[model samples]
Target: MASSPFLNEVRTSIRVRGMSIRTEKTYIYWIRFFIRYNHCRHPTEMGAAEVVDFLGHLATERNVAVNTQRIALNALAYLYNQFLKQPLGDLES
Candidate 1:
């Protein structure tokens, strides 16, 4: 079996866990943005620092709405906890 990429694994797991289609789409969207923002760097090579910067950019630079920002956070949380199977520890404000 082909091992899934981090993003794909996140999507599958989220769907399997019964997240709504809208939630899944939002999560996947942010995850894709995270990858592209980092120049398509694989999620395996990224850590919380990248996530923090991305989230900050979403909230401050892009001026995303609060719910949109929360979606980004949830996407990264799924990437760390489910896809990468790594503990993300505490997020810095």
Candidate 2:
């Protein structure tokens, strides 16, 4: 499948910041997962509630380790705070 323009924009943002290739890939993967998890909704249409739900799902349903959950959170944090310029301030997860 073709990549979404939004993901491309993310790659551009990552590169501009001199982030490592692995970090770029990881962030993209998690962002894509987040989008898909929310039924492909645009990130701008969602906020902290969705983020909290997703992370909770990771911890409870998926049984992911704390570090894994933290990584996902970091990815989403960057997606909002840096890329979208809509900070999800103090998400409760």
Best candidate (score: TM-score):
2
Write candidate 1's Cα lDDT for 1-93 as tens digits: 333376676778898999998988788888888999999988879888899899889888999999888878988898788777886788885
Q: Give the TM-score of candidate 1.
A: 0.84
Residue 62 in candidate 1 has what lDDT?
Answer: 99
Model 2 over residues 40-74: C-alpha lDDT tens digits?
Answer: 99999999999999999999999999999999999
Instruction: State every prediction's TM-score relative to the real structure.
Output: 0.84, 0.96
Error of 2 at 19 (Å): 0.3
lDDT for each of the candidates? 0.83, 0.95
Which pairs of residues collide in model 2? none
Runs of candidate 2 with Cα error greater than 4 angstroms are: none
Q: How far off is model 2, as Cα RMSD?
A: 1.1
